[model samples]
Target: MAPTRAVAATQMIEVDRLDRLLGAIYDGPTESPPWNTALQQMREALSAAHVTLMLRPPSSESHGVMINTGQVTSQGVESYETHFFALDPFVRLPEGEVVTAEELIGSQQWLKSAMYQEYLKPLDIRHLLGADIYTKEGIECRLRITRSDDAEAFSAEDKALVKLLLPHLKRSIRLHAKLDYLECDRQLFAGAVNRMLVGMVTFAQDGSILELNQEAQRILAEKDGIVRSGTGIALSSNHENRDLQRMIRQALTGGPVEEPVEGPSVVEAMSVTRPSGRAKLGIVVRTIPLGEFTGAKQRPAAAVFLRDPESSGTQPSQEVVRRLFGLTRMEAALALLLAEGLTLDEAAEKLNVRRNTARTHLRSIFCKTGVTRQTMLVRMLLNSVISLG
Candidate 1:
């Protein structure tokens, strides 16, 4: 076969493999994919000192396949999994790019972490080689290989294996993201419909109801009275009205028509104290495009904003957390500083404590609140209260 034909055949074979991988991934619908065995097998497949996978872009914080034949983990694999993945410089790595561990540290990003001291030095993780399986939209999926103390950097064969497997990895990622997105969309739609105050009814120009919120149903029911059947608020009476229904007909006929809705009434309100005692009602219609909604119908959307002025009082002082957590006054002050996004060492200096001592107190604070990290503690504290002062 010609070189061009050979390349085409290779591309076709890879595409078929990718499709099969995606089909398998999508077929297993669990949120936490059962990749434990798969990862272990892949590490064995790729010849390296140690191999690992880092899922990227949205960052589920996984440090995948590990080969420890060289005694890489001293304490336990779980310890590394629990603590180190959060601080791993390997996860944020861009797609199609390779990294060396030394280069990672020399870049100055790793010096801020306790991880550098905790893992890298003790385990003797030397050279690192990794690649990102890039998506068209630039989301990176990290695949990594770690070299041990004795081993040189990854060899050419290792890189070739990664290149060979890139297509399969990319397909799994796309299917996983699609499932994730659809799930999120379902949740968001349910939440929005449940919370909306105004009675919403979306209709095709032909008068078919596409969607409605609960509140909208209630308001419509009030006008139409009790419904023994689903037909109570059926098609608009003006559907047959040539002039008025023309708008709905025109809308459903092609895509959309900008015309007013002629309902009996719609609730509108003005200040009760005004001399005129203004009462408003309308059958206002708005034009929409067919491309707006995901389905066949035109999308009619509205944002409902509600404010409860009564219970919007400020939170209790931060002193409460200080008292509860047994924090020193300075530590409590530092907690407030961290809640505002200050660093631990910055908080330490501001509170006049040594960094190590402040770190101890911070850990204690995290333990007391059931928070495992500074970021979590800061977020929780911010939600409840303000500065102690």
Candidate 2:
């Protein structure tokens, strides 16, 4: 039958509240809206004393993220987690459907069950309405509204209201999941770059510093030859500074080159002398192409890599070398020493092994890494991304 005018007016008020709830869900910078506020709002709208949102169904084996109104005490929540979760009938219901305890099992049958006698009875919970907002890939997110024994059973209008809001809740869950995954990827990328041994600095089109890894900060802090001058980096030698600035300008303005240059157009390598007259610092400037126009305010135009010859930079971890090339501990150590610019005799002396033994280890490393010569092996190791860490 059609609803009376008063009933329709009341339903419209509920609809407005649902609209506000959705706005709260998607409006904030957080992965999801503050559930305490939203769930309280839901409780009032549904005329229930308590509401809860669970990212996954509770089980004895796993605990999931849960937010609830104050109606459920900490002890109650713990008890449910420990024992009553396995007794929940709502968890066994079909996914993506909004249902109530009465609809799932008759009221009399539920009252007789141990879940009610031992669990719900103590908490005074007599009615529950539930819906699964997300169910896929072994994950389940659900919402539940509960009422005490003195309250009436949930009406059809209440079920309809929750059902209407299900799609919006599902979309919000998907968005939060995607944001979480992207955040994890960002953390991993930042961690790998920060741990690199080579000093890496990225520059904008205007020669402004964009970003620098930890090693770059260390190198600049030394202030031996290269240091930060205003927003851009500067070299002690005027000639090398001019050359670096010119190369940066060319890289930013020239765009990407289709053909390879004879020797140094693509990459410019130079040496900067230290004030203390120690080993010179090697610097390589390479262009970073803007792949496609994205209308970003700041884009990287060039990358500067600084290598301190005396600082023992960019040494691959022996464990990583062993795992990658299937070399034993001794062979991996010998290979790493060679990559560090040591000759066979020097490496043997450092390792306290005979020259013949070093040679044998060197041959084993070559066989594992599929290189025929020491120069090729060193080049491969230096070029590998493992060297960065």
Candidate 3:
């Protein structure tokens, strides 16, 4: 009876350890450096001299991503990736199964291998436990844990712990990878929008600003026509403010009540007056399509696009335009000026060239672009993909 009670107590302790391990693994995706804390926790739990998560395995084409928590130096990691990665024998183990160096290659062979004699032996690491995780999302990563040469070999319990963690680790890695991809896409589109100098403002159902890009921040900071008003935005004129508010309400509530809704959204546009008397700000309001189960409280419900007529200096890169249209440097510059609403004479003066030289370049541009008129050439250049560069 006494022996059975002791065994039950040991099981309870193991359960508690497993719980802590599980917590770290699941929360790994939200960490700042994603999985750094979880890797550190794993190293402590396994009593490892070093633990490495190979998010990508090194190849001839790429160095790969690696996260380490232990006694290894950055130089040592670089050396392994550059030279010793190819010689490593304990890799490509049975997927989803925890394995040791001795189990994969005999202890004698492992010690005699070049990877050990040159790399592992220098680090004083002798014992190795590893697992390869292959997720359904086509992600493949490796977990490597090592102990010093003098330390005892990994126990059966250690192998079991890692085996239990493999599945959760795979899921967390998949989640982190998906989030990373989405963030990259968001940055790409946001950067393009900023390059176009378009001010974008998104709103919640309660009319609070949910997200505003860099250009939007600049426009609101100026406070010429549209300004940040408490949680929402306001126009300089009271009449325009009322109209803006009405448009916002319609966008939030799925468009005007009198119209038959054709789709999930509605579009409305108006020009807002400025107190500074520069130019009117063009405002476009549109509803964002809601998901079947999405709640609107703090989520993005509507978007406002603000275009300032006075902010006309922004245009596509000169080099990109030159390459895209196969134009000479002067031709590209002249086309850009024309796209900015400049007359041919004004463009030539800006370029410090004679009117005849500007006319010749314009003719060349028209010939290359297959446009017969100046207006068509200007429209074509404005609509080209050079702005995305």
Candidate 4:
């Protein structure tokens, strides 16, 4: 074949590999330890000893994150992060350009650098190809590829290949960061709701349960008032179930009004009776607008929140209560005991303090909380966001 034809054939082969590389890159957001597969593919395609991705650069405060594929030792990784990271001289290259250590600095100069001599040399990594990626969201990361001392230097084609992958890698990394943030937010909200002792159940349009929190699972497992019936949920009372089912259907249909609205009237609320003669469960069925919820094969159509009135409310921590009400630790303890329905003398006896001291704390709590009455103090503390912490 002619030189042009030979180059064309080589390009065609690389084009096939590019498709797989792109697939791995885009699929990275969904992967656990994201971009592992993509990095592995890049390593194989480039015939490198190791491929390291610096998701976050090391700082004085943090060691940051590093993901690698191919032969890598834990000790080497730790040393790089803890000691040699600051000494690295080949970092912060022109964004998106692939350059080798030798190209960045002279071969002799690269070997003489502290980072190379003290770190990379011992690891058997002589040839280094690096690219820096910056996203619109202000994420800065590095892609580092290494080869052994005897290995051939990175060629022009290798540089070109890395340059081609940069855009896809940048976008995928941004997507992964966004997804990670969203997941963290979801956990934060879920934890707050669980701490408040509320049961949450996400339902599909078909009335099947999509997701349920820990509290909901516990409530259903007890089967006092509500229980899981197949993929759906059920109440012990037949009449209550009918009403609950009606509310579910209405919520799934977006109610009589097509447009979304805000307020307590937008959703239906009811009291569910338990066969065990316990207090009624507060049930609120609310519609989830179709347009608001995106992605997932089975989207949540309605949200069912169950609040057990008989169950003791979340016990607020004394420290949190103290911080919230600006009261001393003793006053905070007395306030909690009062919130739990204990009389002043009874609280004093339990606390092993004199009645006069208890009265002094109560008076101080009232002054700090701006509530003159004991009932108001109890209500204020119970309604506070201290438990959500």
Per lDDT, the best of the predicted structures is 4
TM-scores, all candidates, are 0.35, 0.68, 0.87, 0.90
Candidate 3 stretches with Cα past 4 Å from truth are 1-17, 255-265, 295-297, 312-314
After superposition, the stretches of candidate 4 with alpha carbons farther than 4 Å from their true spots are 1-14, 256-266, 292-296
Q: After superposition on all CA atoms, what RMSD does each candidate show versus the true structure?
A: 17.6, 5.9, 3.7, 3.5
Candidate 4 per-residue C-alpha lDDT over 140-165 given as tens digits, one digit per residue, 9 for 90 to 100: 99999999989999887777778878
Tell me the deviation in Å of residue 104 in model 2: 1.1
Best by TM-score: 4
Candidate 1 matches the true fold with a TM-score of 0.35
lDDT per residue as tens, model 1, 163-256: 5556666776676667778989966775544442334445654455566566555544543321212411322233322332343344344423
Score residue 326 of candidate 2 by CA lDDT.
90
Clashing pairs in 1: 95-132, 199-216, 205-248
State the lDDT of candidate 3 residue by residue for 1-389, as single tens digits.
44453344345346777677778888987886678888897898888998899999987878888988987788998998898899998888898888899889998998899999999988899899999988778788999999998998987767777776788899899989898899999999999888777899999988889999888898899989888989999988899999899899889887784565676447899998888888788999999878999864888889999887778546678899999989999999999999889999999999999999999999999988899999998888768787787
**Runs in model 2 lying further than 4 Å from the true structure:** 1-19, 32-37, 47-50, 58-61, 69-83, 121-124, 135-139, 148-153, 195-317, 343-346, 349-352, 385-389
Overall lDDT per candidate, in order of appearance: 0.52, 0.78, 0.86, 0.87
